[model samples]
Target: MAIIYPLQPRLSSTSTKIVIGLIWALAFSLAFPQCYYSVTQHYPPRTICMVNWPDDYGGKHHLTYQIAMIVLIYLLPLLVMLITYSLIGQTLWGSEIPGEASDHYQNQIQAKRKVVKMMIVVVMTFALCWLPYHIYFILGSFNKEIYMQTYIQQVYLAIFWLAMSSTMYNPIIYCCLNQRFRSGFRHAFSWFPFIKVSEEDKMELQHTQTFRMTRSYRTENTKSTVVRHNSTQHDDHTTVKLMKS
Candidate 1:
């Protein structure tokens, strides 16, 4: 969206980049397993309480790791995204740019709304997909009995796939809702065997390109006009001085 839409926030500011880097580092550091002591050499039993521990460990560190993973990976990121998107949404819809017409402004607002809506959908999908996976860990961390149940392994497999499936949906979302991505997808598809790019696809890609070019020209033209007007006034003043002399 940032590539196609000029108005989209790119977060190119140095401070913002630094903050993002810090956040990513923190999340990554927190996600690493700190309780390697609790990890079994083999997988945990599907239906037994007969696990041998090297020491008289109470698995408190394991619970802490599980809680950290849930907070850092899922909850923390989700909260941050929600807040960021909310600010973006307010900026898009609340503020109006000068010289934009009512209809054009409305269209811009609608476009931003779509972008925000897409972000929200992505976040929600992630939450839903990963919910079961995290819930399993949370349950196991708090209740050893549930962790030792016969059906626990099967449940883990199910939630694991559910979480894994979220990664697959992002491309579909982009192709379906984003015009630039759709055009790019079509262009790429044209290279495949027995596939040809349609004229409409070509036109859509060209149209977006042309629109950007036109905007650049308009901005440059406005600056040129101001300079020309100042030059014209100076020329007139010189002519008057020559006539008076």
Candidate 2:
């Protein structure tokens, strides 16, 4: 959506909702198989929950699933983001937002630069956060000794926490980098005395709403004007034909 933000025929609320639902459904569906294949072993004191992975005599289901997940959930997304954001960055920096006043055009360009920078930071952060965990998973899968070391548990915990930290980084990035997001955050916590939500800051969100309404109104008005202009031309042609007859 952000990639083609300036384009026409954008997704409506209903379409967006359906897409969100489909994404969640696909994620859950893909995850269901792993859950089904998991095994719980009770070893007296501490029970271990693990995948029912195969060995020499068994099939390669677990290994295959792990590879698939690493590709689908990690590598593919990373690759896609890298490509799309690179294009977006190039477009943003290279192109000009024409027809605006000089100051307004400069401001828009700066805004685009900020947005691209923020998105790049987010992508890099996410990639870094998960790199160690994915590497550890791959190592452990191929080499059983990777999991046998004394410091292995500590290493796993650190990597797991790093991966989880990516989720926390995103909102903070948006709040710090985007004015509207910061404004919304301020509005949400207006009860706190220290966080002053000024009327200008409040207008940041309302401005978006007002802008959309105004743009739609302009579009409808243009369409009506075009229709009227064409109809008048047609009526003039009819009058000319009647006089000739």
Listed in order, each prediction's TM-score against the native is 0.64, 0.80
lDDT of 2 by residue, 140-215 (tens): 6677677789998898999999998897999999999988899999989989989998888978889888978997
What is the TM-score of candidate 2? Answer: 0.80
Query: Residue 195 error for model 1, in Å?
Result: 4.2
Q: What's the CA error at residue 161 for candidate 2, in Å?
A: 2.8
Q: Report how far off residue 167 is in candidate 1 (Å).
A: 3.1
TM-score result, candidate 1: 0.64
